[model samples]
Target: MEQKFKRNIGWLQGSAMTIGAVLGSGVLVLPSLAANMAGPVSLISWGLMGVLTIPLVIVLAKLSTLYPSAGGIAAYARQAFGERAGRITGCLFLGTVPFGAPICALIGAYYLGHFFLLDAGGVTIIALGMLIIAVLANYRGIRFSGNVQALVVIGIAAALLASIIAAWPMVRKESFYPFAPNGWVPVGTVMTVLFWAFVGWEMICHLAEEFEHAKRDIKRSLCISLVVVNLLYLGLAYVTIGTGVYLEQENLTSLTGLLESGWGRLAGSIVALLGVAACYATIHTYMAGFSRLVYSEARAGNFPKWFGRLHVTYGTPYRVLIVLGPFSMMVLLTGLLLQLDMSILIQFPGSIFIALYIIAMAAGIKLLPPKSISYYCAWLACIVCIIIYLFSGWIGVYPPLLAGASWLFSRQRIRVKNGAISG
Candidate 1:
């Protein structure tokens, strides 16, 4: 018998999950990266990206209400375009978690090293330790993890809000001069990069079926999460650039530097701890979503049945969580061993997510009834996704290549099965 998930999540948990997932290490690092890429004009990029996400959010919210499932985006793709498209969507999603989890974990770990004066070895150990903790939290089930996420999101929001308030008084109007020093072209470039910050909302979709009132609560959560995320992102961007700390320091350390400049070392340390909590929230949500995705695929006969098994006592996908934990650690360890920059790993998943967003938006258009509000929103969202993909440069190419390979393998398997049946 196939096991099922309990709908124990309410609007509060759903919103917290969305906010926690969306408010990851990006808040700590992206402002400086955006400033560097497009100068203070990246502020415009931040606003633009946030506005563009509205259509996508509306479309996803509508889809969730209509077809709520643990598979989330993959299920929508499957319904619109058949099994192959759905499997590809699921594969791409599952592919991202191993890389995304470590990338987020390392961000938290890196900042912790700065706070504690830890060496690379210490940081690597901390990263692995954090991954294990996240896996354990998730293995207990969504109800447990969801409660943790609510508190985590509150801490992160408070930290970011405090930093913004402290920095606001120090803002210089002079920093606005020469806003587009790199020209308007880089705004588009930075928009693609900043798109990483907007990715968590889609991730929350995977848990739609777990909502107490999927139709009402999912849409309500989406709206609230988006508003909260955009306010924090814009506030952080303004403070990072307006205070001019980002202009003076390395991108990775700029957020810490900004907080320290205003509120001293203690403030920086507190923010770093909050950053670690934020990263864990993201990893926890991703693990939960990815396990369900794997379970969804397995239930559909796309993956090995072992992955579909749930723990009898905990009622969680323990097998998938157990497998994912070590796999994520391996990625983190390999990166540490190779001395690879975290940015490379981060960009790989960001690109794949862009591709997934495109697929989801198209699926929304096809699956929803035509001439409706959602239909138009899907069209606009699809266009926005394409524009971002075009600006994503070489970073955008890898996902399609991966999806094509997956498609080919899925097709070959289908042919073999047909041949066996015919024989």
Candidate 2:
């Protein structure tokens, strides 16, 4: 008997999951990195991305209402275009899991190292452990995972609020001088980095089938998460600039310094724990989303069938989750051995996501009613995606490479089918 996903997610759970996915490690690190690149004017990138997020989420949410499936953006692509396009989009999205998920886990590990004064190797070990824990959480199924996500989201919100409030009085006006020290070009450049924070909106469409009332709840969740996420982003960016925490600590641990300066060592310790939880929540949501996408693609005969199986008892995509565990460990280990910078890991996926969004929004234009409000929104989103992709610099080369890989896979699949038929 084949198992199907359970409709255990409501609007609140959907919101929590969406929030967790979008508000991940980027919040902890990107502000400082952005400040480093563009000075205080980096806030412009944050503001621009926040405004752009509105239309992107709307196009995705509207699509989910119309075609909810585990395949997410790929499903929309399949419906709007053809199977080859769909498969390519799915593979492109899968690309993020390999490096992006582990980068998120490493953020938590960095915070843990900061809080405990651990060495680089210890941080690597903690990162690997965080990936394992995330896989375990998803193995329990979405009902259990959704409940856990809600609590994690609340804690993340509270921690961000507390940090911002405590740091408000310490904000020095002098920090705003020479705002565009690197010129406005870097402000646009930083948006490429900040794109990682906004990457998760498309993730929820993968879980659309699991929502109890996907059409209604999807919109509701988007509305709630958008406001909540943008506010936290802007507030945190303000304090990071005002307190000049970016100038004080390494970008990875800037949040710790921000919290310590505002509250104290105790608050920093508490935030470290919360940062770990926030990163776990991110890993948890992406784990769930990526596994489901693999199952969908495999079920559609785009990959090996071995990945298509769901856990009979839990109704979850257990096989894919199991495979993800090992792959993530390998990425973490390789990152440690090579001493890779987190920004490099982050920029790779940020570029890939912009490419993915461009396709997703194009799918919207094709599938949605012509000139409808959502259709216009899709156009707006697609345009912004293109602009961001241009800002991705050399990283922009990745999308064409992924497209080539997808074409090769499709050709091989066709050859196999023809051979089997002749045999």
TM-score per candidate, in order?
0.95, 0.93
290-315 in candidate 1: lDDT tens per residue? Answer: 88888888888888888988788777
* Pairs of residues at least 3 apart in sequence or in different chains that clash in candidate 2: none
Per-residue lDDT for 1-423 in model 2, tens only?
665788888988889999998888778888899999899999999999999889899899999999989999999999989998998988897678877888888888877788789999898888898898889889988988888889999999998999899889989999999888888998778887788788788888999889998889999999999999999999999999999999989987788788887677686687678778888888888888999999999988887899988888788999998989999889888888888898677777777878888999999999999989999999999998898788778878987898898889888988998999999
- Clashing pairs for predicted structure model 1, backbone only: none
Model 2 gets an lDDT of: 0.88
Model 2 TM-score (2 dp): 0.93
Task: Tell me the TM-score of model 1.
Answer: 0.95
Candidate 2, residue 422: the lDDT equals 100
